[model samples]
Target: MKKILLLLNICIFILGKEIHAQTNFPYYQDIQEFKKKDSLKFPPKNGILFIGSSTFTKWKDVQAYFPGYSIINRGFGGSTLLDEIRYVPDIVYPYHPRQVIIYCGDNDFAFSDTVTSADVLNRFKILFELIRKEYPAIPVDYISIKYSPSREKLWNKMKSANRLISNYLKTQIHAEYIDIDPVMLDANKKINKSLYLDDMLHMKPEGYRLWEKVIKPYLIKD
Candidate 1:
């Protein structure tokens, strides 16, 4: 009886630790809000899952952009690839998505100068492998990190990370690297300020419209 009680205590301790860790995590409230919404009425399975950073989270009308396709946007606060990996079970696993679209990694460079391009690439590979492990047949697309006017200095690092990820995806099956940079650039090959909001980091509706044109063809049709 004592042995059984000890085992039960251990299990409870481990569960408590997990809850504590989750609460301490960045954007924990956002994750809980997602759970709250899911509990209310879960999104339909087999939809396109967009999991990433503020770029996607700020896209409140992502579903409207892709009228026919069902989009599940699980993006939270300015999340990095590491954050995405940490919350994979919460965001990626629950849904049986037909396709997964990712847009992250730029924050890693912007947030910390110590984080190299290779670091971002490695983080992406980890996230990709996690998804592929569960859903090998489902198409996984990485939307190349865009050049935000606010993070102009990090553009070189972003470009490097983008190239690395793009090349890696080329070798993997059912993976595509969608480049939206060209469309976002102007005559001088700089990010168009008009597409972004006053902050110059997040996009306006016009930016999303541009993204729609590029991303539409790649989406899987039912």
Candidate 2:
């Protein structure tokens, strides 16, 4: 009887530890909100699904920006590439989106001092593979990391990562690298201050207007 009691205590401890670990995960509440929303009404399958960090999350008018298209935004703020990878099964695959447009990697670099351009590329490749493995032939578009005044120090690293990913995408069918960095730059080849919000990181309405023009051409047609 004592042995049985001891084993039960161990099992309970292990279970509690797992629960604690999950609760402590970054953006756990955001993911749970998504799950709750899903339970209430599943997003339409075969629509364009946008997933990424705060950049995409803050684009609350995404659907309005692209009228006449079926669109679903699953972006969570303060998320990184790894966060998307961890939640892909919950936030991505279930939607069965016809196309996936991603805008990540910004927070990845901001959050880690040790991360490199190659590391970002490898992380993106992992996400690309995960999607392709499940939904072969579905088109995926990765929006290049933008040049922001706030993250000027990491500009070179972000540019290098974009270059690597863009080059790799060229070799894969149904994969596209949307480069909007150039447009975000002024004629002097510097970040246009007018495009960003006061924080100098996130974009303003003007910035998204530029993004819309650049990205619309690549969007899949109905």
Candidate 3:
């Protein structure tokens, strides 16, 4: 009876540790799924790699947008720039992409009120520097945070962060800041409600169509 009780306690402790780990690292499972897919057949190198939050992840038909170019979409859940920095090895480094386009920072602002535009910009800079450290020649592009009805309150902070990143990119070689926000606005310079889904957070097909048009010119062709 004593031995069984001791074994049970050990099992409980191990299980508890696993639960804690999952909570702490929210996208572990999502990344593992990507690994599983890659193990079957890894994508070709020197392709365009898109890494960020659900905006990219939810783009299930991203390949359709750009017909000729090879695209590896590594966007996970509603992840922040910090999460991209953490998982760079698993998502960014392995592929050796010719170009990396990012769409993050919005989630960082959404998730925490205290997180300022500068804070998010700093996080982005950390990520950019990390990538440059590994692949100095690789071209990196940033898609400006979109204006959405659901997160209207945080638009100002998002715009500020976008401007900072855009200016910073201008100072670096092989880096492009793809500003898609202005195109997303209507004739009156307001966020077009029709572009977003019912959630008013994630975009609809119209929004993605706009992205396809803007992002096409920036893609590098071998």
Candidate 4:
């Protein structure tokens, strides 16, 4: 029995390392450089962050929209939930941020036949558990998955995955679910025509405007 338990622990540890969490990616290094440049031009971090995948990374006008807030955009394009799980130490914890607003899993929903939307939620759930262990009292805010204009094919999966995360978040008292998806969508439940770029995957300036609206209210002064 003891021998079986030892083998189980070993397997768990091996699999833990096997998962493709974002490591020292060049993108993260580029972001580090951007932060240095932004510091030279703007102000230093005062404990606020918008952390996530491409959506957060692509938000170039963060400072313009968020005045008086020391916003750190720790966003890396093309990152999955697994990458988030791996890179939390680099992106999240080090800053000792007062609040973290996270937006991810859009790319996870992009793949058609691999993991189901429910499975993606499962990964996120595990991520939340791990994050809770790391930062017990800090509030974690989630931005609902946005509709990528050109990626209508990935929309259903995005909704499904977001629903699972949102529903779970509702049950937990520690987190806040920021509902930006609805306002971003048109009456037809499709992404607004003017909101996205030509690529169909990214938001244009107007889309970021709507994001700043709901997100601005939650900003706690440092």
* TM-score for all models, in order of appearance: 0.90, 0.88, 0.89, 0.80
Please give the range of 10 consecutive residues that has the lowest summed lDDT in model 1.
5-14
N/CA/C clash count, model 3: 0
lDDT against true structure, model 2: 0.85
lDDT of 3: 0.87
Ranking by TM-score: 1, 3, 2, 4
lDDT of 1 by residue, 49-97 (tens): 9999999999888999998999999999999887787777788889999
Candidate 4 regions exceeding 4 Å error are 1-46, 187-189
Candidate 4 lDDT for residue 66? 90
Write one digit per residue (lDDT tens) for candidate 4, span 7-100. Answer: 4534443455344233554355655664576567743544677777888888877888998888878788678776676566556656777777
lDDT of 3 by residue, 1-222 (tens): 544644454454335435534565778888889999999999999999999999999998999999999999999999998778777777888999999999998999999999888787777877888799889998999999987899999989988998999999999999999999778889998889989899999988888999999999999997
Spell out the clash pairs found in candidate 1. none
Query: For each candidate, what is the lDDT?
Result: 0.87, 0.85, 0.87, 0.73
Q: In candidate 1, residue 155 scores what lDDT?
A: 88
Off by over 4 Å in 2: 1-22
